[model samples]
Target: METLDKLFEDTLRDIYYAEKAILKNLPKMARKANSTELASAFETHIEETEGQVERLEQIFEMIGKSPRGKRCPAIDGLAEEAGEIMQEAKDDMVRDAGMLAAAQAVEHYEISRYGTLAAWAEKLGLSDAVPLLQATLEEEKLTDQKLTELAVSEINVEAGNAAEKNETNKPRAPKKVAAK
Candidate 1:
């Protein structure tokens, strides 16, 4: 007999897997973004995502489970879609637009998962997990909003206003990071 408690744990593991998958994918997305604003947003989200992963680990502790991830096909698919956008779009602004949409897709998926996990946690009487899940949920929603704002305020304007010149279509050289 399947119980909500079991369902909750499964969902938790799914999100844990998704977050880890997202961590691996974000740097690639950041490098591939032509818009500095979009790239910077990806970089910032990496830190927020690190915090989200920590919260997921804490929730696992409350449930007496080790921090482990079940394979999440949804995240895998989203990552594949992002990769496709990176590969297919040759124009800088075009790539930026596609990447922006792909990123928001990831955020939307995360928001949905976190919302469900938080609601289930509360219903299951896991008070400790609720706050942790809710915190990540809020972060996901905020990231989604910021992405929207970025697209509207900068990327769209840049895309629309870019001159019809060869220079506008060229790929950018990524900033060299200092090795720690």
Candidate 2:
């Protein structure tokens, strides 16, 4: 019979893997982003992510376990989707929009994972672990909020305008109305 302690450890490993995976991918996302702001966001996240990993390691030490990670399919799929956006969206504005969306997806995933881990730590009476997890959770939320502000302020509108302009430039087929 597995206990809450085992489940807590397993969840910890999952987010640990996810944060490490994110660190590897953030650089590519930064390079691919057409927006200077978007690129900077990714770059800043890389540093913050490094700190988040260290915090996770601290939690592991607190519980007397080695810092390790299990494979996380959620993050893998999100990273793959982001790669597809970079490859598929040719226009700078359109690509920025896609990249921003991809980043938000990742932030949402991390927010959920960290929030749950913090709650579980509290439940399992691992009081020391809760604050570290919560801190990371707050960072994830702030990242998500920043992405939302960027999307609303610039990316989405620019992408939409580009699409609209392109559509207007294209030849439209004439519609035939019969039996009026």
Candidate 3:
């Protein structure tokens, strides 16, 4: 069985990879977003992700290990799906909704990873690392909540309206001619 310390280190590398991937992808997401607020949110998160990466580096230093990332397939898959959603969606409102959903998916993944790492750090008595992990975890949770609020407040309703408009604009069957 892998020791808890080893597991913690492995997870750290995974999240480190994820954060770097996110930094590269956020600009695309921001550009694809229809709402200015949504775009701004993505932009803001990019800076926050930068900080998270630095925090991960600090954790590595605390443990006397080099700061580097291993392959994190889960983040790769999620990012691919998010990109697909942006490309596939044509309507602005609908695309915004899709982007919000995709972002929330990423945030949720980060939250889970950070939470686990923090717990593992605590269990391994790496008390110094716990606070760093917990801070990232909290930021992930807050970002998720903000995405939820944005979806509920505007994006979802706008998408619904767009769907309704499309349905209303569809061609209808011709009416029968009147019989004399």
Best by TM-score: 2
Give the alpha carbon lDDT tens digit for every residue of 1-180 in model 2.
198888889988999999999999999989988789889999999999999999999999988999999899999999999999999998899999999999999999999999889998999898988989999999999999999999999899999999999999999999987986
Q: Against the hidden true structure, what lDDT does model 3 obtain?
A: 0.92
Candidate no. 2 TM-score: 0.97
Candidate 1 clashes between residue pairs 3 or more apart in a chain or in different chains: none
RMSD of each: 11.5, 1.1, 3.5
Candidate 1: where are CA atoms >4 Å away? Answer: 161-180
Clashes of 2: 0
Instruction: Give the Å error, residue 62, model 3.
Output: 0.8
Per-residue CA lDDT of candidate 1, range 1-180, in tens?
199999999988999999999899999989988878889999999999999999999989998999999999999999999899999887788788888988899999989999998888889999988989888999999999999999899887776665456556888799899999
| Cα displacement (Å) at residue 107, model 2 | 0.7
Order the candidates by lDDT, highest first.
2, 3, 1
Model 2 regions lying over 4 Å from their true place: none
Please report the TM-score between candidate 3 and the true structure: 0.93
lDDT of 2: 0.93
Please name the candidate that would achieve the greatest lDDT relative to the true structure. Answer: 2
Q: Give the range of the ten consecutive residues with the poorest summed lDDT in model 2.
A: 1-10
Model 1, CA-based lDDT: 0.90
lDDT of 3 by residue, 30-143 (tens): 988889989999999999999999999999999999999999999999999988889899999998998899889999999999999998898888899899999999999999
